[model samples]
Target: MTRSELVTALAQRFPQLQTNDTGLSVNVILERMAEALTHGDRIEKRGFGSFKINFRLPRTGRNPKTGQCVQVPAKAVPHFKPGKELRDRVG
Candidate 1:
């Protein structure tokens, strides 16, 4: 689901919280996660999953369209590994 859907669901689940408050809560949670990722920190939520950064080395890749060699720059990407609880639930 999208961000707005999550906000709506959170607001519904916690009737004591206002929509604006719920929105802020959701935004804060997302912002914190982003900040952690930006610092190369890993996040692990019990029964959910773990998020970490993976580094890809620069490499030469072939262009499928023109069959020409291309240089691909190195980059750090986010990776997610599901927890056992989540995997079990899905399975």
Candidate 2:
């Protein structure tokens, strides 16, 4: 589900929590996660998954349309590794 959908679900699930409060709570959690990733930190949630960054070294890449060679810059990308419980549940 989308972010708004998640907030709505949380609000519905917890009747004591107002919709606004639920929305803020969700936003805070997501913002913290993003902030941690931005700082090159890893977040591991047991029974769920681990979030980390993978670095890609500079390399040559080709343009699909013209097949032109291009230099690709180094970059860090967010990566996720599912925990065993999550993997088993999905499977």
| Poorest 10 consecutive residues by lDDT, candidate 1 | 18-27
Instruction: Output the worst ten-in-a-row residue range by lDDT, candidate 2.
Output: 3-12
lDDT of 1 at 62: 100
Q: Count the backbone clashes (under 3 Å) in each candidate.
A: 0, 0
Off by more than 4 A, model 1:
none
Q: Which stretches of candidate 2 lie over 4 Å from their true place?
A: none
Candidate 1 backbone overlaps, count:
0
Record all residue pairs in model 2 with backbone atoms less than 3 Å apart, i.e. clashing: none
lDDT of 2 by residue, 15-78 (tens): 9999999999999999999999999999999999999999999999999999999999999999
RMSD to native for every prediction?
0.6, 0.6
- List model 1 lDDT by residue over 3-39, tens digit each: 9999999999999999999999999999999999999
The alpha-carbon deviation from the true structure for residue 17 of candidate 2, after best TM-score superposition, in angstroms, is: 0.4
The lDDT of each candidate is 0.97, 0.98
